[model samples]
Target chain A: MSAVEHAVVDQLGTAEARALLMTAEFGRLAFIDGHGPTVEPFAFALEDTAEDTAIVIAVGTGSGARAAVGQTVAFEVDEIDPVRRTGWSVVAVGTLHGAPATVTARPEPWPDPDGELVLLRLPAERLTGRRLRRETRRAGRR
Target chain B: MSAVEHAVVDQLGTAEARALLMTAEFGRLAFIDGHGPTVEPFAFALEDTAEDTAIVIAVGTGSGARAAVGQTVAFEVDEIDPVRRTGWSVVAVGTLHGAPATVTARPEPWPDPDGELVLLRLPAERLTGRRLRRETRRAGRR
Candidate 1:
């Protein structure tokens, strides 16, 4: 389900990146586990407090749950418009960290000890984004 | 363009993955550089050898050119589908390998120099993928 059709790399303000992240419900977290690399799907909530910091919180029981903690991770998100044949993606790679108490206590559905909530405060050491352009013909231009 | 609207992971074959990668002229290459981590976008060509491997070949100048040689790297390709409200992505994290003579002769275009024709061999590691599912009513009878 990966559409790598078109992409353009650009850097935006951390605030803007945080807002763009909020528009999505989930993302694929990529990490290097054992002998090779791995990617996992997780539900995440983005929080923008510092100018260059964001928190992606997720709680799961999968192997990725434990390994992701205290490790370098990459979060990949994309929004595609099939009809328009256009789309874009943004990637933020940083460290997996814990969340603030006040932030965790909010309406967030982070898994409690009942399941264990794992959080990652993405410092976003690197952020690369791309947008795909759709072919368009001017009026009366074949 | 980066698709941040809807994204879900799904499993796919090398062909399905290659199809998406080829449609787009460029994708990102990530590696553990001497300086923490680095990611760069490059144009590549995919060759499905008789041997169960999807090869991605790319070339560059001083930028990431030589750095990629003989090193292990991960290449990511993705897109977003608005109508479907889902994101699709494919990542091949393997060795940054050299291309066969034939592959080297006929390289792909990057729409720019520094961007060379690189070759990636998809051991077809993990066909990890997904897509977001939005609720939609079934039939009128229902």
Candidate 2:
């Protein structure tokens, strides 16, 4: 059967979304550069605080996003079953900040580094997500 | 072994990137809304012409991206091997547009539709990608 034939969509809460975000090791970061809106996949670590949750990403010194410091950014993570069309996607929107020198719990950057790698933060301002499920529905069901 | 131990990153050409993008069934659409930069996963169909390669997405009438007509946007698709630390990611930057009524080819929209659904196009202006691979280095190799 086709995926759309039995798909159901549900919204997820911030807490649940954050929990899912933590489980995924990597996600895509979306930001604006001189050309336009762009996306790049990167590995990230999460930092939770009493007030907010932020994402720590390791980027090369030459990365375009490095120049996008202090700008607004969105990081997205999702798990989808292409065959069944069931999955969940979460997005966190926030301002990008360089990690303070005091923090020492940063995750290791992927593809290993050649030169210096800098850590940038996307302090969580908004967290939202949705889950899709495939379920057969009975006739006349509301 | 970890993905970073022998990882090498390579840039992909426009044709190769577009080909990789066509292999994936779904991708994340990055756009700006009232709040800030946001990302939403979407299923898409590709149309190639002498002029440009356009991404046609089926979205609900109530979707946020539907309101982003004529705005610059980015669509991203990637496949990564967490264990092997190898995979490829492609990003397509373009301007969003409403699809013409005459078009017939469209990918099925996910989560099922409540009311009417519309087809939106992101006419790709730039297509870029990168591949990560592992190569064991000899002890004597620099």
Candidate 3:
């Protein structure tokens, strides 16, 4: 936490959210598993096709997401500075599938690189984001 | 990404996961909305009561998490250094509810001030984590 004691939280627009998502290297994918709602972080890249833009992630063949194909999932990515308490988070929700697009070749999982990996894609149907702004007030400083 | 090109990823035990959770000041709470799955980040603290270990987060009444009461949710927190491409992430899944335990008064949201805030609790039934380790190799220095 910084000496900054004030913050402003603002909701971002769709285009802004998409732009932010493109800047992130990894994000968490929330999907239903045998236990229930589960979230796992994965390195991802944005894929653009003729029809739409999708968030593509690579995971090991044994990863749980393989069972969640066709399910509606939420993908979230954010950059927050713990000390400054300022950052933005963007979330995209849509259907998850196994079809690998041309862009999928670019995203490789940081872990399990040597293992058998598969590409999972989520259509960016709904995207939303929020920005947190932090400011510090110095004493005797106008 | 760090100059270190090689890395190792390891699965963490429950105790290690919980310990990591305690070290982070904020995490993303994944919950369901009428549309579908959604995720939002919030500053949180781990609360240990007589009954069980609960994750406490404070949000304004207008926050979506208020609707998460009685719903099973997944809470995730992680710290990853993009430069080093290494970090650890922990996820806790449980049912959400409204109970201002002794730990409730401690956590304060960054944007929302006092008076309008409400404490939402999640009893962590399942906790898991993973760590990424990066190592750098020099020519003839292996």
Best by DockQ: 2
- Write down the TM-score for model 3: 0.87
lDDT per residue for candidate 2 within A1-142, as digits (tens), equals 3232566778899989988998988888898878878888888889877767888888875457887788889999999888888999999999898888855447657654446898888888999988888777555524
Docking class of 2: medium
Better structure of 1 and 2 per lDDT: 2
Please state the Cα-based DockQ of model 3 relative to the true two-chain complex: 0.55
List the DockQ of the predictions in order: 0.10, 0.72, 0.55
lDDT of 2 at A6: 62
Residue A103 alpha-carbon offset, candidate 1, angstroms: 2.6
Model 2 chain A — which ten-residue stretch has the worst lDDT? A1-10
lDDT of 3 by residue, A60-86 (tens): 754678788999999999998877888
In model 3 chain B, the worst 10-residue window by lDDT is B105-114
Model 3: C-alpha RMSD to truth?
Answer: 4.7
Off by over 4 Å in 3: A1-5, A101-105, A135-142, B1-6, B101-105, B135-142
lDDT (10s digit) by residue, model 1, range B32-60: 55544455445555665565444454453
Q: How well does candidate 2 score on lDDT at residue A40?
A: 80
